[model samples]
Target: MTSFIRVVKNLLPVILLVVVASSAQGADALPSWSEGKTKQSIVAFVERVTAEGSADFVPVPERIAVFDNDGTLWAEQPMYFQLLFALDRVKVLAPQHPEWTSKEPFASLLKGDLKGALAGGEPAIMQIVMTTHSGMTTAEFDQIVRDWIATAKHPKTGQLYTKMIYQPMLELLAYLRANGFKTFIASGGGVDFMRVFSEEIYGIPPEQVIGSSGKTNFEVRGGTPLLMRLAEINFIDDKAGKPVAIHQHIGRRPIAAFGNSDGDLQMLQWTCSPPGPRFCLFVRHTDADREWAYDRASSIGRLDKGLDEALNMNWTVVDMKTDWTKVFAFEQ
Candidate 1:
């Protein structure tokens, strides 16, 4: 019995060594990120969480990572998906409202003058959204989104709207899943808008997407209890709304979060506020040659306060121009 016990004890150290070595090797195999502190920090954090017997080791279930959809997983310009929907809506409603032919933004939109339409600013955008998104049931709104993505093509690239997703972000999503991390899209975009293609494009299912939502009501339709999406805006999951949405929907604060604008600041702040291993990443669109690059002043995907906060917080900021080997999957 003593000899048997001695043999078992001797084998245990070897087993532990093999396990540690294997874990380290696995962590080392992460995709080749850009050479910088951001890359190093990501690798280190992942290793700490995944390493066996490590104090920071997190189980697969608890390894929740959330990412902002627009500008993080996909492109947000020439405009947001909701904005595109609103634009399409404006065109559809134009026939009924003949007066729009003479209006400022509507007149511009009708003439395919995107610049003029956008020049009217947020009020103009809200008017478009209200006209289209409101006065419809949830199912109808979802169908509208589904139909649009199915047929819509980007104006400049002439590529299907869904094809505009960032390639590196997609690879990162896949990599996280492989590492036993549960990835989610926490965006300010509409929930229904994202759910349409999130699964097909990002491999993240509808349930994993939490976003802005209109008021919903449970109604008996044909003796069946159906959830109806009302046009009344219930939440705007941007800025401060992001953290509130995260708490209400996800139930647990994300250990890792990725975002690209000031809209994501509150979410990142919330994620980092908790006492535990955490990481926050900001995707800075600095590659005008490869992708669009307008930060502080850009009307879309504005990154002013968030950029400064990222610097102060020591958050990983991904420079699209420098860090990314490729921007879009469709890019040659």
Candidate 2:
């Protein structure tokens, strides 16, 4: 019995070392994030805010984190996903709108010339939006968006649009929520449009999303009441408008903000301006091999002004190529 006990005790350290190593590996909350200052800053911020009895410890209810949808949570290269949806919608309805056969922008769209269609700028884009999005009940519009997103493929990558969401951001969202932070999306895309996929893809509920919107009216049709969409601008949730929408919808200032474009500058400034602990991060697209590489010169999802402000404000900027081990979840 004495000899057997001596042999068992001799192997104990090896067993303990394996268990300790496994526990340490399990402690990493953001596995998709590569080892760098960007990831370190993110983890440190969360730790400081959540540590009990610490000076920077924030209460659960006050741990609000707002994230922008396009270019932040998902890939917005080539063009915004919402714009793609709108274009596809136009094509689907083109057979009915025969007048579009000779129209300027619509004619270009029908010919699959996305560049020519958008050449007219905001006026041309708004025309497509109004034609496709308006004149339907809210429920009908919801169904249309749901159906389109389920099957639509990104033109370049050939992946479903939802599949292009950043894996690192997905880990970040789940990590924040696990730590009692309430996550909300403040996007420039249409509000009703985002609500369709926000819950399914990001685990954010419909009410937690705020975005650009058009006017709607409550009406009863054949004893059934529904909200009818209108063809007029209601609110634009980009640039300075982001902060205003945050104030109106959230009713409290966010403690952290994440985004990727000049449009998100005001939102990040609002989040980090107050005299308190806050976090602001912008995702920089720098991977040409795996994803896109564009910033200052790009028309869509421009990051010029936001990049300058992020540097001046000392906010963390995540380089997609370096800060993340993998860009898409499927890569894992």
Candidate 3:
């Protein structure tokens, strides 16, 4: 039986080797993304950047990656979180401002006519935000946001708004960070609003988030210096403003960028236009059953011009219907 024991011992090493190789292969494969050209391209690009001894291997500091919020990182379907906040603000302030009972947008909002409420366009939206978000200290505003997020439930899904974040995108963020990449969120949403839960939700800190911001004044309040928010618009971080915000906030051009819709087109163009190793990805919402299916026609997060440019620029387009196995964390 000595020969039998020797044979078993000899096979053990081979078995161990096979198991290790299989695990390594699995690690390289992102099963979360479906088997297709898009998935293949994403993996290839990541491998090129991450592979040691490769010419395209970017160092940590230079490996800055910027992602657009809203439809890219999370689900911005039915309506945006900021719009919901505006609606809630309208509700709260309705009792105080009885004139809103006869106002166009406010009356529509009170009557639950979303379409009518938004008919007044950007001007109306800004009015809602200014009225609700202004006249408070930054700290008070932050606290108000915190309180709202803690109790706010999505109007249609009935789920906590934070829980609606895409699971695959969350995984992607972790994967990028694990590969020594620093990710930042450059969104059109209010900076304070995003800073409220970005760290807890996406592992992105407040400093890493750049968004539309209001003017603030430095003042000594009671015992310490405080930055009081003024009732004036400072920067609107959208469209062309995206690249400027990136440059001002990050002080460096990003090597990688991810976004959805035309608002982020400029940011992606800025990243990929440079003569160097760069990667840009556009998250396409094509899943109807899971979360949402929108592209050309949607009022919010419309992916028209950006979609055309993505094809022309050879950017990786993540097809939500095929690429992702799951959408939101709450889905599973």
In order of appearance, the predictions have TM-scores of 0.85, 0.92, 0.89
lDDT of 2 by residue, 147-262 (tens): 99999998888889999999899999999998899999999999999999999999999999999999999999899999999988899999999999999999989999999999
Model 1 Cα displacement at 205 (Å)?
1.1
Candidate 1 lDDT by residue in tens digits, 3-35: 999999999999999999898666634343566
Model 1 spans with C-alpha error above 4 angstroms: 1-32, 96-108, 111-116, 218-229
Clashing pairs in 1: none
Looking at model 2, which ten-residue stretch has the lowest summed lDDT? 23-32
Best by lDDT: 2
**Listing every candidate in turn, what is its Cα RMSD in Å to the true structure after a full C-alpha superposition?**
5.0, 4.3, 3.9
Query: Roughly what TM-score does model 3 have, to 2 decimal places?
Result: 0.89
In model 3, which range of ten residues has the least summed lDDT?
Answer: 24-33
lDDT (0 to 1) per candidate = 0.84, 0.92, 0.87
